[model samples]
Target: MEIRKSRMADLPEILKLYEEARAFMQETGNGTQWGTSYPPVEQVETDIREEKSYVCEEDGRLAGVFYFSEGPDPDYAEIYEGSWMGSGDYDVMHRVAAPGRVKGAGSFCIRWCAEHSRRDLRIDTHRNNLPMQHVLEKNGFTRCGIIYLANGEERLAFEFLPKDI
Candidate 1:
């Protein structure tokens, strides 16, 4: 699969992927991560318009979407009772969605961000998202701790730093 910057025209497909992700989360008993209101369509649209979003394609079909931004995320700035790995500059990922095609799309996105940014990448997931936690761990993302989301819900945070850069 190839990763490319998302365009305004990709919003519908990206929204569809988000819906699928929400359904999958519910089916897997991890609905708290994205519920029905997370990553509002307006925000997705904004991300697309601002060129902060990306989509993964396989054979010309969209497979996944994610947001890649540099610096500490505003939502993640004040982690309630936990601390991050460090206070250095970092790249943060948000709103990761997969079309349920390949099992490792999330990992691929994380790896891409880490390699392209050439810096520590941080991500957060709902506490009950075991699948995501497993993927992060398998891909060398160490669990830093818990942090509150923009909506004020606590989530487990993880970070992956490249060994050489």
Candidate 2:
């Protein structure tokens, strides 16, 4: 699969991917994480406009999408119950979704992110998002601790640092 920055023309397909992902989450007992209208179109559009959104494509079809950014993300500033592994720069991955048509598309995207990152990588998931937790761990992310959103919604945080680092 190829990973590339999202463009305005890809908006429709990206929205559909998110919709299907929301349904999959609901069916898998993770409905509350994104609810019905989370990651609204405007946000996706903003991500595209800002060049932080990306898509995974295979043989001319989109298989996954995500938001990645360089961090000290403000929301991650304070961790509870544990702490970050390192004290330098890091990259964050968020809003990941895949339609499941291509096996390992999401995992591929995650591993790609880790391999390409110059700094450590960080991610978080809803407490109930077991599938995501599994994928993260499988991709070598370590459960770091807990972090709260602006509204106080708690999330299980994870981090990945290359062995050489």
Candidate 3:
């Protein structure tokens, strides 16, 4: 699969991806993370507008979508249990959703981000998101600690730094 910036025109398909992911979570006994209206459409739109939304495509069809941006994340300002890996600017990833047709999509995105990223990279997932935790671990992200979101929800934070650095 190849990754690229998402466009406003891709909203319909991107939303479908999230729906599918939510269903998968429900079937796997991990439904509460996204709940009923987790990723609001407006949020995704804003990510696209900010050029932070990325889509993974396979054979010309969208396989997944995710939010990846580099900057200060106030929600991550403090760590409850662990600490961040780097002190400088860091890239944060969120709202990763994918369809089953494209296996390893998350790993692909992680590699893409790490390859293009010049500094630290971070991601957070719900406690029950074993699949995502595995993806991050397999991709070399170290479990730093827990962090709270703007909504005051806790998430397991992980970070990845280029080995050469």
Candidate 3 residues 40-94, lDDT tens each? 9999899999999999999999988999888678878888787987888888888
lDDT (tens digit, per residue) of candidate 2 on 1-165: 899999999999999999999999999999899999879999999999999999999998999999998997888999999999978899999999986979999899899889888899999999999899999999899999999999999999999997633
Cα miss at 116, model 3 (Å)? 1.4
lDDT of 2: 0.92
lDDT by candidate, in order shown: 0.83, 0.92, 0.86
**Between 2 and 3, whose TM-score is larger?**
2
lDDT of 1 by residue, 51-135 (tens): 8999998888888999998876887776655577756888888888874777678778877887887577888888888888887
Model 3 backbone overlap count = 0
Give the range of the ten consecutive residues with the poorest summed lDDT in model 3.
156-165
Which pairs in model 2 have colliding backbones? none
Ranking by lDDT: 2, 3, 1
Which of candidates 1 and 2 is the stronger one according to TM-score? 2
